[model samples]
Target: MPIPGNLLTTAMAVMPHTDPERAIQTALSLDIPFWPQLPKFDYTEDMYVQASEHFPGIVLDMTAKTLRFSMDKFLAEFEETMAHFDDPAYFDISPAYSAVYHRFLAMDHSKRKAIRGQLEGPVSFGFNIQDQDGRPILFDDTVRPFMFEFMAKRVNVQLERLKALNPNAFMFIDEPGLQFLFSAMSGYSDRAAKDDVGAFLDRIERPRGIHLCGNPDWDFLLQLDMDILSLDVYTNGEVFGSYSGSIRKFLDRGGVLVWGIVPTNMEPFSKESMDTLEARLIAIWDMLAKKGIDREWLLSRSLLSPATCCLVNPDGERTVEEAFAMIRTLSARLREHYALDGD
Candidate 1:
């Protein structure tokens, strides 16, 4: 919760790929902190979820296989709850959630301060769990409320797990599926996206953030009590061009804007360079300044990434190499240009 005293233009990287020791070193060298992501290591992984994927749990009463949670046998426990939903204390994400928390604690020393953890947002996750007819669970009113409550609980659980390691750390609500949730899904009633569901989320532990790789309903998303607004730096700038006024209000209020400048794909990743990156960043800062938003004020809340996800382009060699290199150079530039370390 160190309100980023200065501008923090840094990289958000995939932990498995980044050498643990090197990542810490790179972070300090880059003059920014690291956001560790472990998606590949676990798919139905507690933190991340493919919200649109029709997970089997919604149908057939939460079968054991459907839960498929084994990190700490969460699936087995989930099966017990499903078999006995009437039990007074049938909670979801139970012991596996507990085990994941302890596991993360052991990782504290490896990855330092402000360690980040993520979870799928309610609208997206709720809809992902499906009914037997292959319809979204969100379509079922009886199930929808439960889904939201669970999503909120799950997010809080994930935050607690991580915060038990460092209370001030951040917890990102990985709501990539929100684009569709608010745009096309049935779950999106006027109140579903904000008021009703947000009522539960308002109590979540740690600072909450949402990442949108595609365009989002900004007017609605800006409603959440979120601390950071992460956008696909490459595409969002073009996608949300007209919302400059609202964005300015958000920025002015000390809310961090994660400008995902790095291309999540190849050509753009390869196409960008230090001078190009700096120009783009300064240009962006200048753009907001035009709206009467102070450059330095905006600077304090800006977070950077090479791409939303690790430069995932089939042109892997060129794209990944350039993307990683850009991280180092970008970090150095932001540090030196701003004197982040203090001479």
Candidate 2:
């Protein structure tokens, strides 16, 4: 597919609090279908926490209101099972996998052109699962490979058809945990190493990109094959420059860059304005241009918005409305700069 080479926001999946109509409307109004977040109801409803039937013997759910995993059933089921995390025969998705997919389908098919899906990156997934003692599974050699392969296959089965329907759809694996991954010590397993991380990435396919957000594990991720490199350029904008060589290589490989240009959690609505932010973006664009990375549609590729990053507590409904306002100005500037039309 000839992916549109313009700007886009992180597909902020409809959380528990967001009005479904509003979430779908937000994607439609902004012209982006890939909203990878679904923590709209409670923080614990996260994809990892909402374990599917595919991965049996692992109990990741709790009626708890926060983001902690429930260990009662898990510990009971896997008394010596932390070692089982690496055992391939033990890592089967429950018979209920279809039910989970069915639930996702209900929401994704809610409207036409609903570009709905998720992300699953090697570095992050390698870091999410834990051992029998409830530690980073990546550090446990007996299990890292099993966990990695399971996640890769699981991610594809969950998202493949979603992409088929929307074609322009996207999926993201929330791997914000990669930044903390370091080389293994004598007792720790080295799952985050470039080669180890790349192995899992090799398991997945790409066209609509995966997101690389929060903290920089750039030595590996930015260099991988992908459709976009999502960054919070507005606040953490300085991080991307840390890997100048890798980033340039990523762009040269036809990777689109999605700048998290809007403020979320940090800067509030009172301090935001399109005119002010545009000047900041112009400076960033100029910096990229100096590297011979500038393209006319670069601004479009540079998404200018934020999403309800935290859904459990809920921001204002107008939070999305505020983001749309800035994006509107951005769209106008882009249309004029590129002389684009209703093609």
Candidate 3:
């Protein structure tokens, strides 16, 4: 599939809304609108829970609001689950899993530059969910492979569904857990994480993307064969500057960068304005340009977004709405300042 180019403002995975209709309306307001993951409204919309549907051995307790794996359950349902592994419909995300997915799909998207969908990444899901024995499913040799392949199938199914709505449809693997790979206590090694991610990306048939809201091994991630890299630039922008070589190669290969410039957290969000945020983004770009990466080239192949998902804000959905407004205004101002209006 041809990659979507010159895309502008969009958002991260989750939205802080309880209403699906309102959330879809907010999504359609963006240049590259995405379906909102409304965990506030339903536990099923939780990123990990959304990815857990139909997997063998997984158990969800609505009353306790918890999810876990069961070896006994997995053994019993293993054959049945594998039987439907090849069925695309088996991985389809129905309204039950996403309150807004089907509603978002029902909207008119012909004029959209592109549409985006997101799934909890295998690494994150594996680490977050534990087996009946309290060990992370990621450490389970048998279950880990099954989980990775299961996520790949889930991604492809959603990609195809979005493609039908817009040919430029794409999916992002939400992987905040990736930051753990760099920690001494993570147990999962960096090399193992990279190999797992590379293999997982290979299974995705359409353009693959990863969203890491925390700083990780930039050099390592930039080397992966993903079409887009979305990160929290509000906090990690300067740290990312040290990876100029990787950034240059990534952009040179026609990769897109979703610059998560607008702050989503309450502290930073309160201190920033359009002027300050613009200056911050330009400062990072200037730093890159000094290292020989073309500023104009970077602007042309970039998209703007809120630094991360907005679930932590105390002001609730209003804060998210404000952050997105800033993103739209900032995108337009930058495009005009850089004379990229034609592109």
Candidate 4:
């Protein structure tokens, strides 16, 4: 499992179909093009939309940016929706996803190494959605399983679509909320957390990965069945480096590691030179190597990224494209520097 000399970015970063032709043009420009989450086009593109849509007693005021679920209402719809999980329409993805995907299909992908599709993991989605009383859905016994089914179906659909285009296409479960699982209020035990993630990953096959934008219980993830572990290396590289034993074990078992070594913020992106960023990545490897992982093993298993999604500037959408261009240049320099394998 040699690392693909390609970059990865979430859908939150790219805008599609705002100008149909231009959107596709921008998508093709990336080294590793992925399905974009055009939230600006429609709020439904937010990670939780697929699961929230079939909530039993859901209340949404998109204009006001509010959502409150009704347990009673949810319970009623829960049976039907859960029973119809196999039906394609039951887990229909947003048009924003389809728009980018269709455009991706129409374009030439011969030069692309691997493309990616991402979804909000069940843990994060459950922790974020709340009942009318403001209680988190993760604490609700009835609603929890329903949410898992909802997201599982959604991920299955997305994976099927991406695999149809290319088997090398990667699917990732974004779990930013895992960082708070140990807090008193989250009510998740280590075993329960593993169970939740396992449920979400049950249908996912190889070439799948998990992206945690925040520092999390890395040990738990290391024990999971994912082929890749994507981290917020720009911020948590040291924390991750401390787990050198786990890193060695994971890589030894053929897992890929994506170092989110690039900074996503405009200030850092503008300030850090390519040499500085490359040195930063090398430093991380040096730390891991000291802990007994071979440097070449570390490099062979590594991928590069700009943490997660970078937000668009208040005044200009072009800033995002500029940032991505910087990322493309950085990716090229790193690959050439390491003589990494190409797609």
Which one wins on lDDT?
3
> Per-residue alpha-carbon lDDT of model 2 for 82-110, expressed as tens digits?
55645543433232332233344545443
Arrange candidates, best TM-score first.
3, 4, 2, 1
lDDT of the candidates, in the order given: 0.56, 0.54, 0.86, 0.68
| Residues forming the 10-long window of minimal summed lDDT in candidate 3 | 1-10
lDDT-based ranking: 3, 4, 1, 2
TM-score of 4: 0.88
Error of 4 at 219 (Å): 1.7
Quote the RMSD, in angstroms, for model 4.
2.8
| Candidate 2, backbone clash total | 22
Clashing pairs in 1: 233-260, 262-306
- Give the alpha carbon lDDT tens digit for every residue of 1-343 in model 4: 3236333332233343355456556656765667565656556655566446655677777897666777787767767766776786556565543455556665555456667777787788778878878898888877777677767777777777776676677777777888887667555566676687786677665677787878887877787778888887878888888888888889888888887766656676668777887788789888887788987767766666666566455534464566556666777776677776544
lDDT, residue 88, candidate 3: 98
Tens-place lDDT digits, model 3, residues 1-343: 2444443888886988888788777777778899899989899888889899999999999889999999999999999998997899899887788757888888888677788999999989988999888998887878888889999999999999898988888889999888876677455676777788889999997678999898888988898898988998989999998899999999998889999999877888899999999999889999999999998788777888899887877878888888888898888888888777523
Q: Which segments of candidate 1 are over 4 A away from where they belong? A: 1-5, 9-104, 109-113, 184-188, 310-312, 315-322, 341-343
> By TM-score, how accurate is candidate 1?
0.74
lDDT of 1 by residue, 43-124 (tens): 3332434321222243221233242211133333445545654432232344332333334445543334355656667666
Q: Specify the poorest-scoring 10-residue window by lDDT in model 4.
A: 5-14
lDDT of 2 at 172: 59
Error of 4 at 205 (Å): 2.9
